[model samples]
Target: MTHRPLPRPLNFAAVFLAAALTVELLDELVDGATGAAWPLVRQDLSLSYVELGLLLGLPGILVNLVEPFLGLLADLGYRRALILGGGVLFAASLALFAVAGGFWPLLAALVLFYPASGAFVSLTQAALMDAEPARREQNMASWALAGSVGNVVGPLLIGLAVTLGLGWRAVFALLAVSTVVALIGVRKSPSLSQEAPTGEKLDWRDAARGVVAALRRGEVRASLALLECANLTGDVFRSFVALYFVDAVGATPAAAGLAVAVLTGVGLVGDVLVLPLLERVPGVRYLRASAWVTAIVFPAFLLIPHLGAKLALLGLLGMLNSGWYAVLQARLYASLPERSGTVMALGSVAGMVSGAVLLGLGAIAQHFGVEAALWLLLAGPLALLVGLPRRASLGSR
Candidate 1:
């Protein structure tokens, strides 16, 4: 007997991954730079860390708020337009960032940039998942690998930019160019074909009812809750690790950036190595194990005083945590296969929790110290434990 092939197999995975990879690189590239170069940006503008926290956190507020509407669009099967349009908007915002000279101006630029960036990222992944519903885990593993590349390259870019006096704004120009190229590839790709209608058009009355219903589902609540918890640690690590290295570890700005590179760069190994290793294992199992390992390892990472030891431990941390993104995301996408955008929007909402936590951490650091705040990141993995094997399987509802 002959077996049938996948429906025309758009085979857009390569183009989709390429476009997603470029944006992933740009996102982390700019963000990593922002974290490392904040001292300079803050000093030049005479802003406080509290203000820095606000700057980092507030723009994301609007982004998260808009995510559901964008999800509505995603459910409408407009992934192509969202992907390309969001990218151009983000690049434009980056250009504005290059010229902004003050706090309010920088804030305005980021308002446009962050939400656009969110669309570029979350929607693109939705589109990718749409393209290969069956191979989502593998595709997402590849996607995570690309993001891991950005994680490493982002800090290194910041380090090189600072060391060479190219300035943080200079990196934005390069990213803007890259974003356009990614869009070009997206325009040519076949990844955004509509498979089916996910939900009705966004009528607030209807949407409110639908959202309440989705939130009530066991799979939705468990998966999203655990994910939000896991990301709490992630938010801290992403936003503050470099600063911790600089302020607490007493490393130079450049060295701190390199240290962050070590943390994220080694994650490449995790994404790559875990793909095949966990192929037979369920996504839920991998996620719970990763959460446990991260919780166990973090305190040791903090207590160690030697820079070399911390870096080595960070490498280990990166490896273990690397597969978590893909695996967790696959679980979420599988849980609600049709509502890709809506589910993703809910995930983006989960990320808004970070802004609040980050603000609180900033306050804690301001009063107590940055080191004290870094300790708060352990909440991420500990959260994973609470939701752990009360764990949501795809069919766990």
Candidate 2:
């Protein structure tokens, strides 16, 4: 009897990729849940507006100072320690959030969670890239897909908690448990121990210099620019889409909220669809085409008077740009091969600069109106058009 060969068990590499992608998903899930739960948290803690602002902004700024060094440390052969240790701290921080009595305690937990996420979640991403160098773009598409799922699931979890009359604390407590489960998966994964050689060990100072050298390179600088610019059409656009619907389109708050949902929900569908598309299309070629199409569609989205038409354009824009980050980031890693950790370090520094740009955009919005400010997002696809290499295809690995 020619029985089908027994279904093969997952090999080490496959198991490791699963664990790493789970971490990415969990990371975004926590972020989505936390953002959704914040109003409840603020009411429970009786937080002041200033405190809310601090909670939103302070931890990110503080973590930036340390995450770059953490990235350097990962390159210095501390990836496993950073990821596992950070996972423990991440769970503890969530537990802290579950029980925070006031703003200060909650702030402390936020402070801890940011860098811990950098260590556990971001390093897991780096590890995944190292695990399969030839398949970086493909693997990143999967990672991005996992994150998209997490983002969708997170808000749903909060909604479920609210429906059941369970408090936000319960949601956080559950997340902490999930974090532990993901940590165990990472800890058991054999691939965490393996790293591409990074030459002789250098002290943190030397590693910092290495990051500086990478920034000096034209390709690295361009990659950083592309990443930040891409955010304009991505997270930056999501942040303001609801407001745009309200202020620009004269939509009610309920309808505005639906705008946000459509943006994210459609983006999630795009992420799912992009995985198969990437197998057939070269990443760069697809990005170049996406950029040109988005450049046209975004302006139309702004000019179109009809709300339905605008929504259609927005969904098309989201779908068109689905593989943007996956492809761009894989190219960034390819540009600085064997230095995935350094890529992280560079990303952190670039992030700080990009964070300031958001403020500038906000200032422009306040002065010129959101629609005018959103025009700046045109820079995203335009940047891609300008910066992407002229080559038609990178050819499959």
Candidate 3:
């Protein structure tokens, strides 16, 4: 009898990719759980929409001051250190969120969480893009896929906690534990310690100069603008959907949670399909067409009266916007080339505008109600339709 073939050894590159992707998965899991739990958090803290706005927007504004610096440091070959340190803070912030008794405490936790996530999660993403320079779009699609899966799971976890009578706090506490495991995986990734592309031990001042230079590029500026505008349909939309279901659709808390899951679950399917689709079509071409369709679909989602009809439209909206982030983000990395960390820095700068938009949306929701505030989300598709290049030649498929 012939001997059996030997088992394959571990591929370090694949292992590193998995570890990096896990960080993104956990980050989105936290976001999904938070969005799904907003109603419960609101009731427990007795927070007004304005306070909710502050919680979401102010921390982001504050984090911008820190994240740009962190991004610079990452470009200077400090990525592994920054990621590891940020992971510790990320875990602590989740622990704080679990025990927060009121709005101020919750705000404090989120304030800490934002910059921590920028360092822990965003830097890791940059490292992944840097690892596979030629495959930036494809890798970004994979990243989005991992995040979409997290989005689906996060709401289900909230539902499970509520069903078990453990509550939203329990969900965050569990997330804290899971984050530690992800940190361990990242710590073991050998690829993370590589030097910057220049291979020089540069100072922060040099990194700062690099960021300044990156900002001067028109393509970089356009990408950053598109990213912020596109976000109106993403986390910004997610933050309000469950609340909208509760207030406007008159769904029960359980059903509202289900609404969040359904939206994200369909999005996960879209993310999956977009991976292969990106190889066949220029991402920008796909984006322009999707934007036009989303413009129509979003209004119908709001005007539709029946819950079933709204959910169907929500699923359609999710599918239509599938590769939005991955494509735009990949374009940003392409613009910057090997300077992925600089891309993170520029993105953080752009995120300030998004923070302001969230604050404005909150104020609008407080006065006119969530239904009116939701109309602001139409800006996402509109921005893409206006901003995406008319010809696909700007980026080869």
Residues 1-397 of candidate 2: C-alpha lDDT, one tens digit per residue: 8866443235656788889988999899999999889888888889999999999999999989998888888877788899999999999999999999999999999999999999999889988887787778888999999998988899899999999999789999998999999898899875665353655666777777878898899988998899888888998888889889999889999988887788788999999998888888788888889999999999999999898888888888778878899998988888877677898888888889888988998999899999999998999999999998877322234
Q: What lDDT does each candidate get?
A: 0.74, 0.87, 0.86
Which 10 successive residues of model 1 have the least lDDT summed? Answer: 388-397
Candidate 3 weakest ten by summed lDDT: 4-13
Model 2 error, position 170 (Å) = 0.7
Question: Compared with the true structure, what per-residue lDDT tens digits does model 3 show for residues 249-276?
Answer: 8988888877877777888899999988
**How close to the true structure is residue 192 of candidate 1, measured as C-alpha lDDT?**
61
Give candidate 3's total backbone clashes. 0
Q: Is candidate 1 or candidate 2 better by TM-score?
A: 2
Which model scores highest in lDDT?
A: 2
**Comparing 2 and 3 on lDDT, the stronger one:** 2
Clashing pairs in 3: none
**Ten contiguous residues minimizing lDDT sum, candidate 2:** 3-12
Tens digits of lDDT, candidate 1, 1-397? 9976654533446656777666676787777666666777788789887888788868877777888877766666676788778889988888877777888888988999987876787787887777777767777888877776676677677678878998877877777787787777767777664444543455545545556677889978877876666665554576688888998999889888677677666777778887786667666677677778888888998999999899898888877776666766777888777778778668767776656777788899999988888788787788777766655456322
Q: Write down the TM-score of every candidate.
A: 0.81, 0.95, 0.84
